[model samples]
Target: MDTQQDWDIYDVTIVGGGPAGMYAAFYSGMRAMRTKIIEAKRELGGFMRTYPEKIVWDVGGVGPVRCERLIEILEKQARTFDPAIVFGQAVAGMNRREDGVFELTSTTGERHYTRTVILCAGRGMTQVQKLDIHGANRYELANLHYTITDLSRFAGKRVLISGGGDSAVDWANELEKLAKEVIVVHRRSEFTAHERPVAQMRTFAKVLTPYRISGLYGSADRIARVALTHTETGEPEEVEADEVIVSHGYDRDFGNLVNWGLEREDYGVSVDAKMRTNLPGIFGAGDFITYGSKVRLIAGAFNDAVLAVNSAKMFLEPSATDMAGVSSHNERFFEKNKAVIEEEKQRQQN
Candidate 1:
């Protein structure tokens, strides 16, 4: 006789653990729904993990805070409902039952049961673009870095950064005072980063526009010099550096979710005003979905999450409210609110 727990069927399963997915999990719990989150990566934050040090001031009511700190806060909020979180599973297969339940299979063969699916897998399974030069991988363990894990690591050391996007410029600016020298190499003279940041980076870093890294020169395992060639004239130049950073970009792989017959455009999946995909019980938020008036920002992703979660709730119960009640008056927060009040009172008394 086998004594085993029955398969758990969630009211909604969110794909991806980024801001949108995290917020959806919280909102769904507020609506009294059983929820789960399946994340491809071992951790959360999604694309934001790439720039953990960047200051994020755009989030409403959030004074300029580091992105990594915001991620920690968001993760805590997502776990408020104690939803099951599955990590390091890339969703590859989706099977729907006649009774309307969905069985999602990961590439590793794990299965999850859910009544509704919300794809917040922004830049699903992103692969960082590395330096394409031959033998570049040799220095990766030494002085070559694809992403900035610690800005202080380059303190007092010369740093060479390649790319023209916001991340590249941001890195250059951040390392300006920390590093002995900051060099920015880009294939195009016109930077794609925001105008102000680009201008700010130009004031300090050694800007090599319309040029690209051609080769890396070093001994043993660490890169000591970088060969750069002009994009138009092919003029070559070499610069000595103790560290090399590549911020080219990332390649996105949505796995097999794109094959589920969801209407999609070149940018992302198509969704209605209520964040509902054409398929019933399926929704999208964050960078995974596109509509006529999509706002590509963190705050925008939060708005999408609310709409998507509410849509899923209404799908499960047709008579449900279009949105959750304000948190200030929400009964679910009554105890939590009291706890906070008590803590504050104790602090004041002390």
Candidate 2:
């Protein structure tokens, strides 16, 4: 079948639709390159989707807004130039042809052609860690939660959270006021969370250290109480709970990407100051790649995207401008600015 993907070879293709990938797409357009984004998930936002209800205030100019709202705005900006977006496809292989175009093949056998590739596969297809206790899966739909997507669901209910990491402590502290009671169970005496949050969590939530959820006692797929076992003493106790939250963390894998020979560390793949990876024509950005003084925040990802996109442009044509002009100097950007102004004016008039 003849398709646009078959005939059109993008100048740059971004793998992963996180903040880095989204900004890369927009910046590539400013550099006048045909761009495409390949995301494994059905939607964008990458790891940010895990914390939709969380309020984000650190994305540079963006004010305090829900993570979900920021995702919407980023997606809107990513589509500024109408780049091709391929969803539900993970690129499992990359091969550069003699013609100089890179061929990317997904696990589903779909393929994309591009001149340059930007690796933005943050955490490399992260999978949420789940409860290991027997029959725990049965109560997942009833009350068990791996991540807190909605806060309203726990209104005025007894909530028990497991683990001692930042997420566990943070959630327990937040749930203290809303839930009838907040119980935090950790297997270690010392929590791995920040000292300030841990101190705050101890102020309200019922903290149990060196303990574990040995068993879940529930009826008909609903947890009524949880049996706790002390790791050191083996003493057992039980706590009643209306809801159970596990912050066991995630199991991340780069899948076949690790075999591509990109220099990587425990944190992520290695990239130079210019965001260039070990593989030529293949750059990286976001938390997927690490460098000296690299920041893991959303603002950091945007900065990396700009550098990677500019490097990709220069790689394609050495004579191309070192950087994209500012929005004021970009001639075609005026239409979008005018449209935004008009929309704001309309809102004001209404």
Off by over 4 Å in 1: 1-7, 346-350
TM-score for predicted model 2 compared with the true structure: 0.95
- How do the residues 226-321 of candidate 1 rate in per-residue lDDT, one tens digit apiece? 999999999999999999999999988988999999999987999999999999999999999999999988888999999999999999999989
Q: Which ten residues in a row have the lowest lDDT in candidate 2?
A: 1-10
The positional error of residue 41 in candidate 2, measured at the CA in angstroms, is 1.6
TM-scores, all candidates, are: 0.93, 0.95
lDDT of every model, 2 decimals: 0.91, 0.91
Per-residue lDDT for 56-78 in model 2, tens only? 98888889999999999999999
